[model samples]
Target chain A: MNIYFFKISTLLYFLATMVYSVYLILLKDDLLRWASRTVLLGFVIHTLAFLSRYVEAGYTPVTNLHESLSFFAWMIIGVLLIAGLRYRIKMLGSFLTPIALILMLFALALPKEILPLAPVLRSFWHPFHVIFAFLGNAFFTLAFCCGVMYLIQEHQLKSKRMGAIGKRLPSLKVLDDLNYYSLKFGFPLLTLGIITGAVWAEYAWGRYWGWDPKETWSLITWFLYAALLHQRLTVGWRGRKAALMAILGFIAVLFTFLGVNLLLPGLHAYSNW
Target chain B: MKEKLNLGLKLNMEIIVIGLNHKTAPINIRERLAFQDSEIEEALRRIRSIPSIRETMILSTCNRVEIYATSKDIEKAVQELKQFLSEIHRFPLERFERNLYLLIGEEAVRHIFRVASSLDSMVVGEPQILGQIKEAYQRANESKASGVILHRLLHRAFHVAKRVRTETKISNHAVSVSSVAVELAQRIFGTLEDRVVFLVGAGEMIELAARHLVSGGVKKILVTNRTYERALTLAREFQGEAFPFGEMSVGLKKADIVISATNSPEPILTSEQMIRVMKERKHRPIFFIDIADPRDIEPEVGDLENVYLYNIDDLQKVALENLKDREKEAERAEGIVREEVERFVRWYQSLEVTPTIVALRKKFEEIRVRELEKMLSLHPELTEKERKSLEAMTSAIINKILHEPITHLKEKDEEAMADFYIDALQTLFQLPQSSEVAKEEEDARI
Candidate 1:
């Protein structure tokens, strides 16, 4: 029953994501609202399904790629729902729903593969490291959305199209502010995630830092976002420049999450479900 | 009253516009005819009592004084307007009415739109009038004097003006009509550099015209007003020379362009006066513009060869020609206005559906409660706590079921589906249409 609900919820998220993408192009606020509401509803159902899994499993519920990715998507949605409500930027859902859906779809495609943890894996700091790290990446993802909008708005303003969408989009100043704070919040959490990962690595493999592709790429993502925040705050280079940097950082995050696991063999890759 | 279906059931409604404009009256005449801001309330009271006048707006500007009104008896409103003008100025009614030109209905709406958009301005497509109209609308809105029809009309007029500015070439080339006149002068003379321009008055319009000419590279400006001090002040500001009124002929001879704007009622320059000046300049083509009312320059001066004399009327004709170019872009402007109008109308219509929705929700909740109560009464074996739990379960189920429909109704208010649903709810519940008001009052009491 739990599996069926998750599957249905994820499917609706995918459908809603597609509708939102179409709505961005269609430029209808009403259609966009429907898409966002649908996505939010899916998120709520997905959260319930995840809670049910946790109830049955009697742990933090992260054992393999399937569970981890599903949890990651859920965390992203939770952040989005909270931020969206607080900020009243319903438009962000159009950017985020697709990303959440894609991650969850990947989670679903790999079957139920909750591996029993080794005695070494069962530690106090393990869940905090993984969850906070993923949550930090969630913040970075939101920054990426704001960044993309900033670039589009800047381009449209330069071209003097000044369309309804151009007008409706948040100002460059607001987008810059969002990017700045998202990074400010995410970077420290990421540093903690990396630090905790390091501690976990030292405990499990007798090394605090490994230049593994995932770790290397995650560091690279960290540096890019850090540079963006520094440039924005120190040099006051914002708008399109900051946005491009954010986009690059988000791409690096994607590579760290998916690419390192799938293409490059890594210790984190435990997904032969 | 015969119904005029073509005018949207306004056959008995006569659109009477009684006013004095720059062309028909002098500044003294126009100022006397004008209504001060403080006097508008009393004027509105007086005008509304004048037998058949239904709606009225007093538009007072420096260049124009107009009373726009709809009346069952057109003569009554017209007579009142004339009498008010006479009483205010201590002039005869016959004298005041002679200077007023009346336009009705279609012409009136078009005129107001054009005036608000600056198309009907003394200098066509001048942007100042647009701001002035906005000020007038704001004042009217503040007073709560404007009704539904006037509100829509004024709102539409403002939208139309914005449309004209955005989608048309009217505001693209020239910002002011005076500047356009300068542009024409530049076209005629090839360049204003090393040319002497004579400003015959130190008035604001004359100052603006002189400034435009100076910016266009006129080498020298000769200022000659009736008052020597005024001419000297204008000359000192523009770094030009001041010629006394006695030496007007000398200034005319040296000037390649002569711009006259004064408050004088009599002809300042006659054909005889110009013929003498022309001989001294050896028939040099002098561009003459008399922006003053009541014939500052004799009309016959325009008939003189090598003298390009343009009075306010002639200048307006040029403006009309320019307006023809603006008319080409009117459809594009109307498209913008129509789109904005639809957007505002949709938002307004949505406001109407909100009460109906609230009523529907109340009716649904009532049904849910009644059904829950009946179900609990039938279950005798259930403990009080168990019955309470059942009630909670049933209530949650009811709320969850209603959620999608209520959300759908709120979000899809634009679709007219809400109206149908509202009507259905009213029919289904056999609820009174007045239930929303009563419910609100009842809630307030609670």
Candidate 2:
């Protein structure tokens, strides 16, 4: 039943993405309220489905590829709701919902059979490693969305084309600020996650740093964000460059979280697909 | 009383709007014609006393001053209102005649809807005109200068404005530079709702920017200027903290957004200062809006990561973009106004049958009650309960008898049919020709 609810929530999110897309296209203010509300409703049902999975698994739900993808989608939306309320950028959802919907769809398409919890994955440090990592990735995803919006809005302004999309998107300052905040929020959490993962690795595998593909990619993602933050601090590198870097950071996070688990053979690999 | 009520939706009734707007008149002329709130009641009273001007509403604003009145003769009402305008300001009619525009009947209604919808504003989609119109109507209503005609028209206009506001994209984005600055800050920080804004100058543009930030929900403000006294005064004005000019670096490090509009010969903030500030603040993103004429901040400051700097020219560019967006949305708003105008015209048509409906009901009640009383006198054996039931039965019968005709009369685009029903009801039932209804309404008003 919870899985069914999850599927339903994915469909709702897809529809919400469509609604926000239309709102962005038409610059319709009324559609924004409905779009946000639809996402909120989907988020609520998605939480129920996610929590139920935790109940069933007797652990954090993000154990495998399918669980990770779904959990990532869930966490991104959880952050989106909080950030959306904070930013009040209805147009941000237009860019964010599709990414979330795509993630949910990918998760739904993956294997549904519950994998038995591996003895290594059952360590207490596993939850900390997963939650902070997921949250960090979620913040990066927000940065990616805002970065995309910043580029679009900046292009619109520079190109002298104040079209519907340009008008709907928030200003560059707003996007950059949110982008910076996301990096700040996500980077530390990501560091904590990597540290926890190292501890968990040492406990289960007797090695703290194995140079596994997941660990390597996670380090790469961390470096990308570090560079982004460093450039931002030292040089005040904002606007398009910052936005692009934030987007790059998310791409790195995606590789670290999903690509490593799927294609690269490593100790961190939990699922074949 | 009969003359006052003559300006209904019935035949020969006309609504006339005589006004000077921003486009038609200079600011000097517009301001002269504008009515203060204290003067609105007296003006409405005086205008109502003008012959053929049965109802009057004066909408006075900085951008325009309009007089909306109703009469049986549009030309005479127009002349009276024009004369009133000329006489009140002691200006000759010919002097201001060239600056006034007049619309009669349906055109007047459409003009009102467009004005209420802000499509007719000097800056298209501005929000102040609707409130001004409402206040004008309120004054007219309090003075009893607005009877049924003005009441329906103004009420429908308010509704149309609301519809245009909600249903269209007329007032979605901020077009002003100060507002756009605030808007950009919001986009960057996610919200100014909890952010602290540092105002880095004491210029009019900077004051405007500070106001925008405060209104946008900035929780605290920091004011600094080259002159400490001015900074203290400006900070006191904003109810914010004032810091010494030398502490600007500290202020920059703490502030989320900095708006600089100071009169400086050269750039007040350079790239080096920003780098230090960014480092000190741990590289948190800070938004800088340099609205000063000579540009208070160095242009290269924007090149830094996490520093979003918008010079006045850049803000102007954004403002221009937003204005274009507003113009595009204004087209959509105009369509909404057109739709509302047509709807209101139909409603006005249906409204023509209302008096006859009222009279018809009154005639039926008179006959039913007379018969009921006569029957009770003839047969005193009728119980109070039975009498009450008979009253209910008669009222129900009358309602049922009138339902179909009333519904048919209220349908859209049936003005001629409404006239026909109105005349038939008046002639067949020998209903009083709305003069009695007018007197009754007037009596009720008293």
Give each model a TM-score: 0.51, 0.72
Predictions' DockQ, in order = 0.01, 0.20
Candidate 1 RMSD to the correct structure: 20.8
| Model 1 TM-score (B-chain only) | 0.44
- Candidate 2 chain B worst ten-residue window by lDDT: B1-10
Clash pairs of candidate 1?
none
Candidate 2 structure quality by residue, lDDT tens digits, B227-296: 8999999999988888988898878988998988877789988999888887777677788888777888
Give chain B TM-scores in order. Answer: 0.44, 0.71
CAPRI band of model 1? incorrect
Docking class of 2: incorrect
DockQ of candidate 2 against the true complex: 0.20
lDDT of 1 by residue, B102-145 (tens): 87755666667667777667765568887777676666556554
Model 2 vs truth, CA RMSD: 9.2
Off by over 4 Å in 2: A51-61, A115-129, A150-206, A223-245, B1-10, B26-34, B86-95, B172-318, B351-446
